[model samples]
Target: MSVDVPRRIVIFRHAKADWSQESDHERPLAERGRRDAPAAGRWLASAGIAPELTLCSSAVRTRETWKLAVHELPQRPRTVYEDRMYEASLGELIALVNETAEDVNELLLVGHNPGMHALADALAGDAEGDALARMNRAGFPTAAIAVLTFQGTWKSVEHGVGRLTAYWSPQE
Candidate 1:
């Protein structure tokens, strides 16, 4: 028999970056980004949800963001550094998620924007609310976290199938 397992996806854009660096991939987090990372962690911890696996981009800012926030998790989760995620398109990200093991009920992805922003909106389905609308308009700013929940395995996830459960940011 097929069993239904609820999957929770926690997606966050890397914290604010230090653009003064010469290379985009090597650019570090700005001072405010540094401060916001742990705040994002604490925000997730406050919600009493911890990821089972975390996928992070290899880019410096994303790595730094994951490092700072991951410390706040109640227990350490397995983390993978994915080079593709650094410049991944939304479709690429989705493909990665589809390959996830079924045992992982909750997963976190820390990456960059435009793709991240587009993914969040595309996956949120028909979810309607002032908060989601507000978030959608903001272009998924740095350190923003969006949570989605759905009853299915990662591979089963399709466009607009997940429901936007919660959305938060350091500014909130």
Candidate 2:
């Protein structure tokens, strides 16, 4: 990959889950989440942010969200469901990104919060405008998406090197 090429990482928080289930991993998406996931996917597709690869958490809610969302994409990306991503730490997520193949430029990660939120905050050094400001005001919520762009290969992707191009939530 050329140094001039920019890699984009799209981080997505899984949609609202059905809390009636006892197992965290087993919990499925709520009724609202089922409807919202496709909207987020369409938004990304319409914005020309189609990913070349998707890393999804093994949790039921995350898996279901990915299932519903990809239908709205312009193209189907290679996807993997991993158990580690269910509640991965920022470092773990960074490591995963670093390990991405050089050819893959746009990567979408569907996982849970706290780690995803921290990862976005750590990687994004600068913001365009109200995207970062709004995130600071409301915080990352269900079905929210954060887009980070940086001029480098996946191997070079690092903390505080990304530019937060956009942030969106289903509530909006």
Candidate 3:
């Protein structure tokens, strides 16, 4: 894609996780999560928000969520399960996003919060409709996604450089 082309980023929080697992990384999704994840995917598909690349946390919950959600998409994108994203901070997440290849115009991040939530808020210098307010009011709950649009190369992605174009959640 050209440097001037608009790029989209969907920051997604993994679905609700089962707390019974002793290891956090190995925790699977709860029943509600399974239900919500597919809904999130259908919403993405219906909204025509397909990413060219997907960066997912290496946690079991995230993996499971992606497995369910991706099946609803018309096409599958390149997906990477990154270990560092399990508990990444906002800065760390931004750095990871900056490393995205310039050719990929749309990127998806399936991870945790408050990093996902913080990234959405930080990148969005402005918002459309009541997306910002809804996101804030919802507190970025599980299976939630924030859609941001920005211009320039991935390396230039930074705070206040994007517009929050949309926000969605299972409850909504």
User: Each prediction's Cα lDDT score?
Assistant: 0.88, 0.90, 0.95
lDDT of 1: 0.88
lDDT of 2 at 43: 86
Clashing pairs in 1: none
Cα deviation of 162, candidate 1, in Å: 0.4
Task: Give all TM-scores, in the order shown.
Answer: 0.95, 0.96, 0.98
Q: For residues 18-90, what per-residue lDDT tens digits would candidate 1 score against the true structure?
A: 9874699999999999999999998899987789999999999999999999889798799999998988998
Q: Which model, 2 or 3, shows the larger TM-score?
A: 3
User: Best to worst by lDDT, what's the order?
Assistant: 3, 2, 1
Worst 10 residues of 2 by lDDT: 130-139
The TM-score leader among the candidates is: 3
Give the root-mean-square deviation of each candidate in angstroms.
Answer: 1.4, 1.0, 0.9
Error of 2 at 62 (Å): 0.4
Residue 90 lDDT (model 1): 85
**How do all the candidates rank in terms of TM-score, highest first?**
3, 2, 1
Q: Model 3 — which ten-residue stretch has the worst lDDT?
A: 16-25
lDDT tens per residue, model 3, 23-106:
988999999999999999999999898899999999999999999999999999999999989999999999999999988999
